[model samples]
Target: MSHDLFLAAKAAMKNAHAPYSKFPVGAAIRTTDGRIFSGCNVEIASYPEGWCAETTALGHYVTGGGGEIAEIAVIAERMAKVTPCGGCRQRLAEFAPAEAKVYLCDDAGVVGTVTMGELLPYGFKGGILKK
Candidate 1:
């Protein structure tokens, strides 16, 4: 099942439009109910205006009707281990629980898996917004 998520990410990487950076990235997330959402990095000339793969996938998750994320998979071309950036880590926390499994893929299958809590141990979340 985890490998299925990685395959989805790898397939999404083919759609990345990163001309300037040439560093295409793909991400896939499994919703709590078993649906898989995938996205690839979309780059723009402005650099900062581009969106990461995870955010793209998360956008789909939101528009497709929000739900908890059960697992996440990420893949890059050359990186041996491609983990989500700080922004993605926090974004994932919005849907995934602290113990949600994350898969970082390389060329083979799932290279490693870590919990969301391990990814962002001290993250500041909207829990603070209640006040």
Candidate 2:
């Protein structure tokens, strides 16, 4: 599963539309039922509308059909952990459980892994939306 996710993320990174930051990123998430969704960073002239790779992947997952994300993989060029950004973290919390595994990778492959809870300890769940 890790290998498959890594490949998915790597494939997505090849198409990153990062004209501004040049910091291309890719993300892939696997649903509990064994479906994989992947996306690459897409940047727009207006930074506010640009979506992170994680958010884009999550969107794909939801749009296809609602599912619980069991695992996430992120790939970037750098050696550092390529975890999701703050906004992406919040987006992930909505579909992934607190213990969901998140894999961080570079061109060479996975560099590390962490749980969703660890990445966003105090994240805002969808409780407000439920109300």
Candidate 3:
């Protein structure tokens, strides 16, 4: 079921623009409706100001008429199971439900899996902001 998402992530990783770090990363999001959106890390001379692969994927998801996110896949050229960063975790939680699957992938395929809640146990809740 997740093999396609892994493939999308792997393909996106190949297009990453990380010359400065030389570490390309890719991310893919799967909507509940089976739509897949993939993105690669884009870096510039401005250092850490560039967006992450997950962030880029989220941008696409939102622009494509945001839907319930069911699963996610992340991959990097250097790390076998590179999890989303702190900010990316929160960003994912904003759209994906707590039980949403997050797949960690290596060069070959998915190496591990975690839930959105597991990724950010104490993350800020959007509901709290509305209160």
Candidate with top lDDT is 3
Ranking by lDDT: 3, 1, 2
Q: What does candidate 3's lDDT look like per residue over 15-101, in tens digits?
A: 999988889999999999999999999998998779899999999999999999999999999999999999999999989999999
Provide the TM-score for each candidate, comma-separated: 0.96, 0.93, 0.98
Off by over 4 Å in 3: none
Q: Model 1, clash count?
A: 0
lDDT (Cα, tens digit) per residue for candidate 1, span 1-131: 89999999999988999998888999999988999999999999998679999999999888888787889999998686799999999999988899899998997879899999999998877879897
- Point out the worst 10-residue segment of candidate 3 by lDDT: 122-131
lDDT of 2 by residue, 22-87 (tens): 888889999889999999999999975799888889889989895888899998864457789898
Ranking by TM-score: 3, 1, 2
Q: Deviation in angstroms for 12 in model 3?
A: 0.7
Clashing pairs in model 2?
none
